[model samples]
Target chain A: MSSVSFKDFRTSAARAIADVRLQSAIDGATLTFRTGRVKALADLPDVDGLRDQLKAIRSATLARLADHLEMFEQQARAAGSHVYWARDAAEANRFVLDIAQQHGAKLAVKSKSMATEEIHLNAELQNAGITPVETDLGEWIIQLAGEPPSHIIGPALHKTREQVAELFSREVGRTLPPDDIPMLTAEARRLLREQFLAADIGISGANIGVAETGSVVLVTNEGNGRLVTSAPPVHIAIMGIEKIAPTWDDAAVWLALLARSSTGQPMSCYTTAITGPARDGDPDGPREVYIVLLDNGRADLVGSDYDEILQCIRCGACLNACPVYQEVGGHSYGVPYSGPVGAVLMPLLYGLAENEALPHASSLCGACLDVCPARIDLPRLLLKLRAEEVREHMLTPQERLLENAVAFVLRHPRLYRALTGLGRIFQRPLARGGLLRLPRRLNPAGERQLPALAKRSFRSMWNEIKDGQL
Target chain B: MITARDDILKRSKQRARAAGDHPPAWRSRRQFDDLSRRFVDSLAAVHGEACVVPSLEAAFARLGDLLAEIGAGRVVVNDEPPFSGVDMAARWPDIEWHVAGRSAGDLRAFCAAADVGLSSADAALAETGTLVVTSGPGRSRLVTLLVSVHIALVPVSRLTADLFTWTAGRSTPPPAMITLISGPSKTADIEQVMAIGVHGPKRFIVILYGDED
Candidate 1:
């Protein structure tokens, strides 16, 4: 795995919240996705039942993942595809590099795949002197801007039209209008068409790998997935070990829910299934096909308490439905996978100590669970991580002391009352109207104002009312 | 040293739990009284054009009119059923037609510059207005993918209620490649603005013929 700098969530979230343009962009994109999901799910005849069916399929698949994988390997090999296993990112990258070297490939066109992003494959290819081109419009935009993807489905969601126009103008050596989205898209199509045709290898991430036929399925709205898999002579697909569908029946359920949850479309424009390399007498398609099953910390998660996290299909509904994610955006999570899924996943994939702030990023909102097609209890997992953090003593000394003091006071009502009395006296100077305006240096609430203490305690009021004193 | 495959498999097996019974196959309750109308409406909802014709001959006539309307100079087609025996070059002598796997002179080159790509769908879904195309001896994946305009002739008999119905009805293993095309290629990556034909066909047309040749 490529080492990403651990920018604490507080710092990045604060920075993101302050950017007005980014805030609106995040708000607009997430709302669109969230609303689309609601409407799309409503259109289904038995969405709840469908969700349950998908969940059961995922659980059953993960339960016997090793056996399914072996079966998949046999079937895929029988179908003339070479299957390789990578225990970690290093192994996966090495396998890809060897393939490129063996083929003497110079250019590789890629469709959007988060698994590749997780392993940072492009950088590895770049170091080995092979040019990697991102063919997805969002991914391509971010690639040109030299930035990490902020959204899983829409990698360039954080960028505005004006910013994209600037990037395209610089690339084409001409000033393009910022508001003309069609013209910008056309420019991208014209430029990327050349790369697609000239590329020697094509790399994609498998959305689902079917064990029945040893097929790798790719879902995309644009036809780039088809072109990438078809245009190149050598096609390589890298998938996480957990992304397996035992049969076509299971794959059907997955496909039915994936698009509806992610983009609110009944179905994406294209869902391509590649069984193996091109068949005999086939006029087009790659001659050689490779499916690299990547573990990269996934196998270790199989039977753990966090095993349910492995059931994630990467639909990204949790991100759109998350309150914290909507406000701060994906970059605030400080990893490729962000939002509620990232909060629980990054800490487990990496060490909890290194990503200590992630588990605390959520407000324990269950919106993610409600919208999740797989119904992974993200908030529960987040709580579990928080408990683990406390158990491991990851909190700072001051925070520990504050927690201890608060616990002690809550245990004794008399002590709490006394402290409240003292606090009311001390807070008189800061109280303005109904809000408390603490000094800038002492305020921990940031932009939000604290509520002033009540003039009389609720206990006292209750006692007076009980005595019939109006 | 154990190979990466063996080591990973061991670790996974050690943690593997007992496999439970697989869930029963889900059947869609959505029944379309008229599959063709539903298919047309669903396809149109996603910016795709669709029409129902009484017979295959009428469908061919409609396709000819579409070709004439677009003023297509070059056309690439898949040599599958319904199109295999037809003499496209003789029927339309004014335009250049490249029949995949049959009369092919650089199919890829023709597809790249072709005005329209023509094929027949193996099956279609009424729920989402999707066409499922499979690649085989004569079917090229790019025929329906690479052109600016794509025209698919789907028989009403191949229409299923939805994806669930299609999956449950399948008796054979899938081909080398199977694609479900719902609409013209589109993107909302740029400021959430919808742009059509970023990489694939800008226009997708479906002609549903009722009668078999």
Candidate 2:
């Protein structure tokens, strides 16, 4: 919330994950999402082939994305839809803000969108005196609590229903019983129904944007996304630059994988393909529609190692699958994006100089890389971020000192050999049988027995104690 | 406001002309099918679906008695093939019948209007009891989606092993929305209760028929 950049947002997310409550939350979410996804995709073997096809399609689409944008603009224009290109978050926010102000939208119903979250849209609108209402149950819960989303799909995964009951009781001005889920659903629904009916402008994010047709694809289990987009006469869709697919078929391929992977549903309850503003004789759809294509540092990724990051569909499958994210939730990432995808992406999109700690939040466990639907090499990018941090001299002085001291001790062969010889003598008291029981003060593993050195150094024993090996 | 967007687009057009479009190498379904076996093997190795049934009739018989047992009435039918034959007025005179058409009511109005729904499959996969339907008949998307208990009439010929057969741009053409339905709509977003048809159809029954055997 302060000027302190996300780069300073350092936490031992890997170590902190050992906490029982935190581990239980992450373990529950990750395994549930992962197992459900595995089941959903299990019935369709062609889905993997489709994923391969999409990998090529996504890479190809990202490569000449500027051209795709042009084609999409032409198609959308031809269909009587307005398209705006925003070079940054501010530009994107201003574009939508202007549209909302023009409509005099007293109540704006918004579906859950990480893109809008990234731009701080709700706050921006409130500052301008327009009420931005979050329609997703998880998002609405988070909004009322005055917090950001912690999970990609389930925004309010951080809070229990009991906590929700208290929050609702205060807002609804009644002591809503939280003994059961039906009460929770009824309480939330009673509140949102009013907002949906009153809202004049509706905003949403696209799962995949079809360039050939200039349609926005949205997959949601809750029908709020559909209601918001259609019930309101003025509908605005804010999408990241990388959301484009050359055609609808490509979009379908990704949609099939997305729904099955994200929530393990055969497909989302609603998969709406909105092409343009309403036409004559068309019944009950937004009369005025605007599509804001946001760059937000995506253009900078065009020719860089992080370019693979653009293949993401914003499904949040990586977050659900990442062990670290399951424990700390999304807020600990201290950015709009989170989890394995966020580790590589937050630095690139939000400015690496301010988000270096994001990359260090992972275990390099490679489980995230394994589960990514887009197959972005998350571990590789995290290592790349670490390298960048070391180059920038952004690491704390203590870490620098430790690394320097270790390097100095190891650089000289004589000193290294002599130190090992001396360490063996000093460690005799701590040695039990063949294992060294390290002193707790010096080593965290002290209580646990550590493997002792061989009877003789490798140089004096079996041959070849190579330099890199040591 | 419209004029400003048009002007910005006009300028963007000039800069955009310099870039090239990216298109991946796409092969015909015939070519893809030959290699598709290998493709399915890889997917099966990673995330395998449960055992597959080749006949839709087998799936239907398993579901038909179940639907009768549930005491569902007021059968609704979407405007599509195979199911276009199920007559609501003639079959059960006492039970109300609704057909999805231009005059078909909207989701909220009709979802509660029907207790049972009949739909025709756009395509069926032998590898799974999955039914694929497109939006040519708008009723197919909404009725199958909104009905409480839905029944699908699947022609055995439409069942294929490879998904590319349907997704690789169909030549005969069906409708606007291509929906591949494997099972009934289920959700776990609220307390992870596996609720069926919270927003879509709660139950699915497939009437698969083949001629030769």
The model with the greatest TM-score is 1
User: Where does model 1 exceed 4 Å of error?
Assistant: A1-7, A438-446
- lDDT (tens digit, per residue) of candidate 2 on A1-470: 21124323433343334355545655676677889888887765565566677677887777677677888888777767788888777888899999988888778999878889888989988998889998777788888889888778877766666767788889889887767665566566657766766788989987877788777777666556666666678889998878888876677568767877787755565666666765553434577889998776776677576678888877678887776677666777765777888778877876666776777778898987776777778889899888988888988899899999889988988998888899888888878788987665444322345778766886865454444443
lDDT by residue (A1-470, candidate 1, tens digit) is: 22222345666776787888998998999989989999999999888999999999999999999989999999999888999999988899999999999999999999999989888899999999999999999999999998888888878999999999999999899999998999999999999988999999999999999999999999999889999899999999999999999998899999999999999999999999998999987768899999999999999988888999999999999999888888778887765888899988888887788888888888896999999999999999999999998899988899899999999999999999999999999999989897999786553326657899999989999999999996
Give stretches of model 2 more than 4 Å off.
A1-19, A39-50, A168-179, A186-194, A420-470, B1-163, B170-186, B196-213
Poorest stretch of ten by lDDT in candidate 2 chain A: A1-10
RMSD of each: 1.6, 6.7
* DockQ scores for all predicted structures: 0.83, 0.14
CAPRI band for model 2? incorrect
lDDT of each: 0.91, 0.66
Clashing residue pairs in candidate 2 are A7-A354, A42-B48, A42-B49, A43-B49, B56-B208, B57-B208, B135-B177, B136-B175
Against the true chain A, what TM-score does chain A of candidate 2 give?
A: 0.88
Question: TM-score of each candidate?
Answer: 0.98, 0.75
- Superposed by TM-score, candidate 1 places the C-alpha of residue A244 at a distance from the truth, in angstroms, of 0.7
Over the stretch B158-202, how does candidate 1's per-residue lDDT look in tens digits?
999999899889766677889999999999999999999989999
Tell me which residue pairs clash in candidate 1. none
